[model samples]
Target chain A: SQTIHQWPATLVQPVGSPLSLECTVEGTSNPNLYWYRQAAGRGLQLLFYSVGIGQISSEVPQNLSASRPQDRQFILSSKKLLLSDSGFYLCAWVKTSGGDEQFFGPGTRLTVL
Target chain B: QKEVEQDPGPLSVPEGAIVSLNCTYSNSAFQYFMWYRQYSRKGPELLMYTYSSGNKEDGRFTAQVDKSSKYISLFIRDSQPSDSATYLCGPYGQNFVFGPGTRLSVLP
Candidate 1:
């Protein structure tokens, strides 16, 4: 069985502070990774996705950026956070078998004060 | 028009009642449809996925897709309070277009 892990389940940062969120998947290799954010009471907004290491596609223009440093490790980062950057961030992975189902991590709740 | 549209419903239903959730899309190129459930402050979980048109059932949940109408539905029979969550419908491809999601409350 495959398991996804995310850290700092909850975070609070002031505006202009740096942000880093990590996601790791065990038991899978070369999986497609994605970063998504959800505003309060709203649906998910895709931020970035990666097919392989050092390859990332930006879905929306924002202060946040994503990186696939390893086959199973993905990181979302920001040099300076904004108040609008506060939201629930999710990391997900999908198999390359042509199936569109995405498995998600527990998620990180970010609050920028 | 948005590629996918769903009613942002705060629908409240009694436990054991039948629940119906729906979504409509304007994109005909979509060949796959999916339903996801998200609890408060959690990531969305894939609950159902279907291809093309027709119905698929898993236990108490039934997913129906009508490609001709560009509509899809999820039916929960004998719903429980544990089923309370936000339901979102999306189309599959290189990029999935998600609906606004519908908030459901199964009251016990």
Candidate 2:
């Protein structure tokens, strides 16, 4: 059984502050990780995806960035946050064995005031 | 047009009634489809996944895909209040392209 974990379940920060959200997966290795932001009543917006360590793809250009420092650890960071960054931040992972089923972690609710 | 489209319905239904959710996609290369259910303020959970056309059943839920029409559907039978949530559908091509989601409320 694989599990995805995310930290700082809820965060409130002022605009221009730095942001760091972490996601880790257990019971799986070499998984493809993704970062998504979902706004109220909107669909999930893909931000970044990592196929392997040190490999990240940006699906949308924004204030955020992602890194895969380890096989099971992924981090989403920003040097400065914007008011528009307020949304539900989700981290998901899919098996690397050519499967498309994605498993998501409990999201981080970010409110940039 | 968006790659995938779904009615963002705040659809309301009574308990024990049948609930139907649908989505449409424009890509002909999509061969895999999935339905996800998300409770308020929670992550979406994968409810069903099917390949190509035809229907797949799991317990009280059924997932239908029509590749010819690029239409997909999810049906929930004997719905409960617990079934009140937002449902999302996606077609897998180069990636999973999800719809805007349909919010369903099964009133008890």
Candidate 3:
């Protein structure tokens, strides 16, 4: 069975501070990874998605960026955080051979003050 | 219009009652419709998915999609308090486009 892990289940950051969230998947290789920010009542917003290492497709351009360093490791980072950047950050993955069903990690609760 | 739309309902229902959740999408290219359940402050979990138009049932949950009407529905039979959570519906084509989700609370 495949499992996804996210670090710092909860985070509190000050404005203009740097932000880094890591996601790693176990038992899968070359999987499709995605980063999503979910706000209250705003729905899940796709921030970035990667098909392979060093290849990322951004959906919403802002202060956020994502990088897939290894086949199973993905990182979401920001040089400076904003108050509006506070939300539940989620990491999701889809098997390259599996259908459209996406598996999500526990998620990270980020609060920018 | 948004690609996908669902009523953001904080719907309260008694335990063992039948629950109905619905969503509509404007994209005709969406070939797969999926249902996801998310607890408070947690990531959305894929519950069920259906291809094209028709119904698919898994245990107590039934998923229905009407491609002609661009409507999708999830039905929970004999709902339980454990089922209290936000339900999200998504239409998938090139990617999955989700709704705002409906908050459901099953009162015991």
DockQ in order: 0.82, 0.78, 0.83
iRMS of candidate 3, Å: 0.9
* Regions of model 2 farther than 4 Å from truth: none
Q: Please provide, for model 3 over A46-87, each residue's C-alpha lDDT reduced to its tens digit, 9 standing for 90 to 100.
A: 899999999999998799999998999999999999999999
Q: B1-108, model 2: which lDDT tens digit per residue?
A: 999999999999999999999999998888889998888888888999998799999999999998889999999999999999999999877666789899999999
Model 1 lDDT per residue over B1-108, tens place: 988889998999999999999999998899999999998878889999998799999999999999999999999999999999999999896676689899999999
Candidate 2 lDDT over A29-102, as tens digits, reads 99999898999999888899899999999998888999999999999999999999999999999988987688
TM-score of chain B of 1: 0.98
Of models 1 and 3, which has the larger TM-score? 3
Pick the winner on DockQ between candidates 1 and 2: 1
A37-77: candidate 1 lDDT, tens digit per residue:
98887788889999999999999888888899899999999
Best by DockQ: 3
Lowest summed lDDT over 10 consecutive residues: which window, candidate 2 chain B? B91-100
Interface RMSD of 2: 0.9
The DockQ-derived docking category for candidate 2 is: medium
